[model samples]
Target: MDHAELTTEQVLNRDIPWETYMTTKLITGTCLQLLRRYDKRSESYRSQLLDDDGPAYVQVFVGILRDIFKEETVEYVLALIDEMLTANPKRARLFHDSSLVDKDIYEPFLRLLWKSNWFIQAKSCKILALIVSARPKPQDGSAANGEASNSKRKITTIGDVLKGLVEWLCAQLKKPSHPSRGIPTAINCLATLLKEPVVRSSFVQLDGVKLLVPLISPASTQQSIQLLYETCLCIWLLSYYEPAIEYLATSRALPRLIEVVKSSTKEKVVRVVVLTLRNLLSKGTFGAQMVDLGLPQIVQSLKAQAWSDEDLLEGLNQLEEGLKDNIKKLSSFDKYKQEVLLGHLDWSPMHKDPIFWRENITNFEENDFQILRVLITILDTSSDPRALAVACFDISQFVQQHPAGRVIVTDLKAKERVMKLMDHESAEVTKNALLCIQRLFLGAKYASFLQA
Candidate 1:
């Protein structure tokens, strides 16, 4: 059977030779007795044994993983550990018990991450993530659980463990070992791990943020939707970290997220994407981007739905309000500044609104004519005819509205760039370039008449 096809239930049904392992001194007598009691037992029976001697079972399992090289034994032990943690994740803390302080519990699982088949690798990644997360945080160079005496012993540092796990997870995302389950498993673990600041930093440092953008789409199947949900969950968690947010701002993450939220009917998917949008809405130019993506209408549409998740409803409301405020802000100078600075010029209403120019014209002079300089640069460098045309129009508007409009435009050497566009192929570009020249040479008074 393919190791990737092995399930926990299938692996658990195997009868292992615990007595043989004990006879060979591979496992202690105590470990044999524990395994006998644990193997083939009812779920309740196993739960009771673990509840009574959870750390001992953890120790035995880690010992077998560290010492045993048999694939069957390793797979069996990992299944046992996986089942144990899956039943009660709080049992993960057993691996960090004060009694096991000297043991390198993380080493075995971290080693298994790269050594074994898909089943072993996947289980190892999951178990490692659980135990590492459940470990007592260190303080004053001591374990928080009072396991400080073994601090001098060589053990796997949490930093090394997390870094290893992140690397493995990223590898899985980049190229899955298991055809169907690998990416989902990686994303699932990341959704849990990214709550840690170190994980977030490591993920961003490894360029893991881009790996997630491709997964942030609407999913139809139950499995794919869950993957999408968890993927977005990872993104939602990342939204709080500033460095990840910086990466997200530049990537297609916003548009992809907006697309998911716009089309997804699943409330959980909608909820998470909305929360991410709300987090990013306040940072940098995300608000403007969200408005540009038409998120306000999406938010309104979402609010009309009868979502049961309180957080989802609350997020939709907050996003709606934020988008509303963003719309108002976009209608003002901030929107124009964002458009110009980003060099994505278009024939938005701001370009033709005389009132918009009359009000915000002098505001452009505040940044050493930074807005005007970018427009001129756009004329020189931009290949998008709409951008070139809009740049010409905006320069013409600046000349028409600002008090030193003509002097400022000419002194910035924008006249040559605008003249260069006058003979361009795109009529929009040429017409706007001619209008700009008229405003520059003919002054705003005569230019206004021509515009009329």
Candidate 2:
């Protein structure tokens, strides 16, 4: 029974049944305390949990969480996770080997998140974020389909766990007086969760914008500059989800974000502000709205203005990139051109059906009027012949596909650009432009605009 008499093998091989372990709190506390120690740096201490050649840790770890949550002893569970991550941070071998991804554990984690203890809620968020982060990303676009076999292997094993986690985080945000560190902590976890496209889509499905926008809006009174930064970061990361881009482009928080970027002296926050706006601008409507909102003046004021503070350069390049990028979308792909000008053209299932267009043309025209103009501008002013060629093709496709799209294109004076392109130096541009002109003539009302 003496401590010195115990062999390393004996300790490493020890197993506790769930029924017996939860019978007494002392045994439960000691196991968690030991795991917590392993989380720290130590010499001459080789935990049995770290055996170079030992049994997989998944069961042991899950057993502890199961028993702890069953008994409602939530205090030390997070420490165990923290220690596992800290001890082997680069690999997080223990956590990856554990049943953290197993669906059965979700109930307990969810229960812990709702506890009155904000720290417990924060830790639960962290643990869930880490588990989701550990998921293996798919190798190709085909893997994105939900029916793909790899879908079953996702990190969040429970179907609704991630959705529930997002709901909880948003609920906390709606609270009037947030817990001391809960909001930022939840947002931090959200940033981690948002890295995955699937989870980004989930955030939108959960109505995250409604919850997050108020925190970053200029009108919000309880402004923690840090909160705004995190909010912007989340929104920026989510913008990469193409399905979600339209919503972000149209959100009311957009103008407020511009105000923050223009006025805030904080470079880190401004970096997110610019990155987010830049992302939204990739969608043609947001780019046009920037013009509609008079964003040009703000970008002009900040252009090349030196910041004496060294800290201001934290995201200066990126902030400049945002401004530089926006200029291209605003202009005619001229000298100020920032990024490739294009739109999503791979028609979705709904878009391919003709009946869908007839019913949706009104909304489609309102949505696409500015984008159509962007294409027209590119066709007219871009010196890059290939860009002009693509612009002509895009316009031609829009007119042929959308109901009354040809009429709209002609009404916008696109006919002038199309006719001019017929003599363009690049044969590709001339060909595509000729195609667009042909499409234009098919319209009922192209003659007035087509006349020289």
Candidate 3:
């Protein structure tokens, strides 16, 4: 049977030769006693034993994994541990008990991650994540436990364990061991592990942020929806970290997130994506980008829906307000200045508004005409036809609106650049260039008539 399809219940059904292992000295008498009580037992029975001596069982299991090499026995031991953790996740804390402090608890699972079938790899990944999360904080040094001198017995550092796990998870994301389960398992574990700051740092350093962007689309099936939710959850966590946010800002993350939020009916999916947007809403340029992506109307449409999650509702409200503020801010001269300074010239409504020109024309003289100089630079260098046309039209606007518009433009050497574009292939560029030259040569009054 393919291990990829094997479940813990199925693996637990097998009867192992505990006596033979005992006879061979592979497992001590104490381990055999624990196994006899745990193996093939009902849930109530195993739960009692775990509740009584959970650390002992954890020690036996970790020891077997450290010593045993037989595939069948190893799978059985891993299945037992996986089942125990699934039953009561808090039982993971047993692996960190002071009694087991000298044991190298993390090495077996980290080693199995690279050398096993899909079942073993998946289970090891999950178990390792839980154990790492349950470990003591560094601030609680060995002195607090009165075992300061025993620190030398520790085999693996938390940093090494996290880095190893991140490498394995990234490898699974890049190439799956199981055709279907590999990516989902990797993402599931990541959704939990990334809550740790160290995991987030390691993931970002590995360039794993891009690995998640392709998974951010709207999911249809039950399984796919859960995967999408977890994927977005990972993104939401990363949004709190600056380096990850920087990567997200540059990647396709925002557009893909908007696409998912726009189409998803699943409340959890929408909630997480909205929360992610709220986190990014205040970051650099994301405000303008979200507004430009038509998020405000989407927020309105979402508000009309009857979502039960209060966080989602509150997020919708917050995001709506934030985007509204962005729209207002973008409508101001500062927004226009940002657009021009960033060299993303476009024919947004402000470009042709007569009132806009009249109201803010003199404001352009601040900083030695920094905004106008950038416009002239755009004419000299921009390749996008729309950008070039918008640049030409804007320079013409300054030339017409400012009292010394023509003189200032000529002194800045913009007339020669505008003249060179008079015969360009794009009609918009040619037309705008002609208007600019007319304004420069024939003055604002005649230029306005020609523009009309």
Best by lDDT: 3
lDDT of each: 0.87, 0.59, 0.89
Model 3, span 1-452: residue lDDT tens: 88889988888888889899899999999999999988889989999999999989998999999998887788899999988999999988888888877778888999999975988899899999888887767676532111222656657767788999999999999999999999999999999999999899999999999999999998899999999999999999999999999999999999999999999999999999999999999999999888767687688889999999999999999998998788777756877876786577888999999999999998899889988998999888889989999999998999888888988999999988998999999999999998888888988767777763
RMSD value for candidate 2: 16.2
For candidate 2, lDDT tens digit of each residue in 1-452? 33223333333333334335535653465555444444333423534546641123433454565565532234444554555554555434334332233324445566667776555566667776665555444553322111233325543343466777777877777672245566777777787777766677777887777677766753333457777777888887877887667666567778888888777766667667766776676575676666555565566565567755443444445444654565555533221112223322222343334454345445435435655676688765668776777677656666766767777888899999789879978897888788778777775344224321
Write down the lDDT that model 2 would get.
0.59
User: TM-score winner among the candidates?
Assistant: 3
Model 1 steric clash pairs: none
Worst 10 residues of 1 by lDDT: 140-149
lDDT of 1 by residue, 70-135 (tens): 998999999999888988999988987778877788888889999759999999999988887787
Candidate 2 wrongly placed segments (more than 4 Å): 1-58, 69-72, 86-88, 91-93, 98-107, 138-159, 176-178, 217-223, 282-284, 306-452
Ranked by TM-score, the better of candidates 1 and 3 is 3
List candidate 1 stretches off by more than 4 Å.
137-152, 331-452
lDDT of 3: 0.89
lDDT of 3 at 266: 97
TM-score of candidate 1 relative to the true fold: 0.73
Query: Which residue pairs in candidate 2 collide?
Result: none
Number of backbone-clashing residue pairs for each candidate, in the order shown: 0, 0, 0
